[model samples]
Target: MTGGTPGPPWSWVWGAPGPPRATRRRGGGRGERPAGHSRPTPPASGPAHPPPLYQAAGRWGTPRAAVRVGLLCRFAPPQLPAWPTAMATVVAQRLSHLLPSWRQAHQEPQPSGQPEPVFTVDRTQVPPLFWKPYVYAGYRPLHQTWRFYFRTLFQQHNEAVNVWTHLLAALALLLRLAIFVRSVDFWGDPHALPLFLIVLASFTYLSLSALAHLLQAKSEFWHYNFFFLDYVGVAVYQFGSALAHFYYAIEPAWHAQVQTVFLPLAAFLAWLSCTGSCYNKYIQKPGLLGRTCQEVPSALAYALDISPVVHRILVSPDPTTDDPALLYHKCQVVFFLLAAAFFSAFVPERWFPGSCHIFGQGHQVFHVFLVLCTLAQLEAVALDFEARRPIYEPLHTRWPHNFSGLFLLTVGSSVLTAFLLSQLVRRKLDQKTQ
Candidate 1:
């Protein structure tokens, strides 16, 4: 080709006419280039003219346009370099790995078909009926099933200690009764009957208290009902204590002064304690008035029930004798007083609200002290019964029907009171919902 004349546009194509083949001129034949001619420089590395499609794509301005060019380049001739197709394949593989995580990050989570976990909440999160004074946190949600409340007996919560203390106490009382029965003729001897009643009452109250604390979170209706029954148990215990004290612990002189009216008054006072407690809870009364209404009758009943023992203690001989019965009586009195103080004062819990939520509350302390008191009281009464058995067995010829009858009547009346009060509470709740 001459410089003055243009070569064909297809000159850049491989195998097209161009310079003489070097292999053909092995022996210097006609295949050799003319002496004046120089082999035309091979066209600069790539095709001399790119396809019009690439030219139209220009500088590949945007990422989307670049992707389109790459897709188009994928179908081009094998001689054309396919850098865009390789880049697109690499990008698609990277996106395949990332797409799931990106979708997961943006999508809402789905439920797993299991119940949501129950957690303890603050006082404000619970219903008003579940609230306690100075207790700010660790209230379980209300309206949970009975199984949930039973399960919570092992869980950490404000009521866990309360339920456990009374439950253990009830078991302890049962063990004590079993041991005591081995020594005394509980069924045959009238003198042992009063102590038997006391043991029975102790077991009743402790078991009822444990059940009350464990299951009361079911609802407002159940809360009132369980605690009302708890009050009845307390009343039964008080009357039982009174019977034991009057029969065994009372001095001759003190018994002479109060014998005519003592049992009757004690029975009345026991029923009164139950009535006051049930009424206080039924009204849902708050503050000092409610506290007084609940506390006063119980205090009076305790004062009456314990009077005979106090008289005997004060009038008895010297303390240096190391009398086991007297020592147990003293411990009983001390523990009862401590229990009363904790019950009324709400001590450490009042000082530090949420800090003692799962443990160490005043009510829990009261339960411990009360259990101790009952244990001491039982030991003292059992000793008193053995010591006075000979004296009482000969003097009292008749079966002491009066003592047992009054206790039974008191228990029946308290149960009736609690039942009536629970019905009233249900009616009030119904009215409120309406």
Candidate 2:
């Protein structure tokens, strides 16, 4: 009213104290018109601006900021002055630019159905001595679950090479056996006893070694059992090697002495290896060498067992003078030593972490050298068998094709011994843990 507001009088308005309710007119409804009264017509166009309460106070004449704020804050408490609506509009425009950027910075739009990447962990997650470089995740023990280990066969990790190398070696040994059977009357020979045993032992070692490599990392328990089997394979192979060496070199009189000492000693060591593996794995002693230390005694035993054979070769009237074969035998020994060094030292990977993880790690190198060593030993054995060509004197044994009975006896006894020792160690460890 102070600013001379322009509108129809309030008395004629609908909700004010105006006309009586029964006399109110309805637009276009049937009704009687009073004398000299004309019907009102609607406006052709709407009002140019909104009502004063809703309009910007400044109407964009100068800076409309004050007007916009006043409009925006008109309903604020009487104690507070209203802010300019133009200022609010300017602030809103500025915020509009920042909102998109803020969203992009903090909330990226990912694909609808994409899966999260698989996570890999660190070496601290695995067993202490068994920790391998380049292996990131999935280091569960064997008893936990089958999926984890089975997945490891397909996944890229440190043990990949170790497992595959021995597996390929097993296949190669099988091929070599097939070729050897084709070339010689392996079953018909009187001296086939030792050769057959050597082949069987060699095959067993390769196969077991491969299997252990594949499955040993599953858990400490699995590690102990498979490593025990591997140790037994080593002992059997070593025994067969010494037997063949002595069979060709030692006389019939000394045979009893060789068998008495070497066979019993080999069996004992094999048993020791089994229990040692169990102790190291279940006990988890910091300094104990569960799988690797077993090889030391075997190495010493092999050296002692072969001493007589070496002496016989040196003193023989017509020693093997074949140059290539001799060189191969020497190479075989050197490679075996190299394999032992790699197994003990964990080379290449040890010296340069992550460098040879996928392909040339120490364990894989050891497997390769083992295959070469076996090939060289086979060559040397064949040459020695040829050099000492005895008359065809068949033995009174039943297994004419192979030493099947002996093979079964040796492997079965070794497995049973290892199992008993493992069970004993497991029970003790469980008690301690409890």
- Provide TM-scores for the models: 0.72, 0.60
lDDT of 2 by residue, 1-434 (tens): 11122232222231223222223332123343343343332123312333353344445443234334433444445413223555688999999999999987787465579553232335566666466654334343435345556566666666666677777777877787787788768768767667767777788888787777667766666777787788677767766766566555454444545544555555455445544554555556545465455555656666755655555545455445543345555667788889989877877766676566466677788888988988887777676566545511221223222334444555677678678767976676588579
**lDDT (Cα, tens digit) per residue for candidate 1, span 1-434:** 23332232223233234334342223122354465564444334434444465557857664345435644654567536545676799999999989998997887564578455485888888888898777888888887777778889888989998999889989988888889878889778667788889999999999999999998888889999999999999999999999888888877788768777888999999999999999999887778889888999999999999998899789878744745688888899999999999998888988987678787789999999999999899988988887866545553455434888898899999999999998898899899999
In Å, residue 363's CA in model 1 sits off its true spot by: 0.9
Clashing residue pairs in all predictions, respectively, total 0, 11
Residue runs of model 1 more than 4 Å from their true location after superposition: 1-112, 394-401
Full-model lDDT for every candidate = 0.80, 0.59
User: Which portions of model 2 show Cα errors greater than 4 Å?
Assistant: 1-121, 127-129, 132-148, 249-260, 274-278, 286-296, 316-324, 354-356, 391-409, 428-434
RMSD of each: 14.9, 15.0
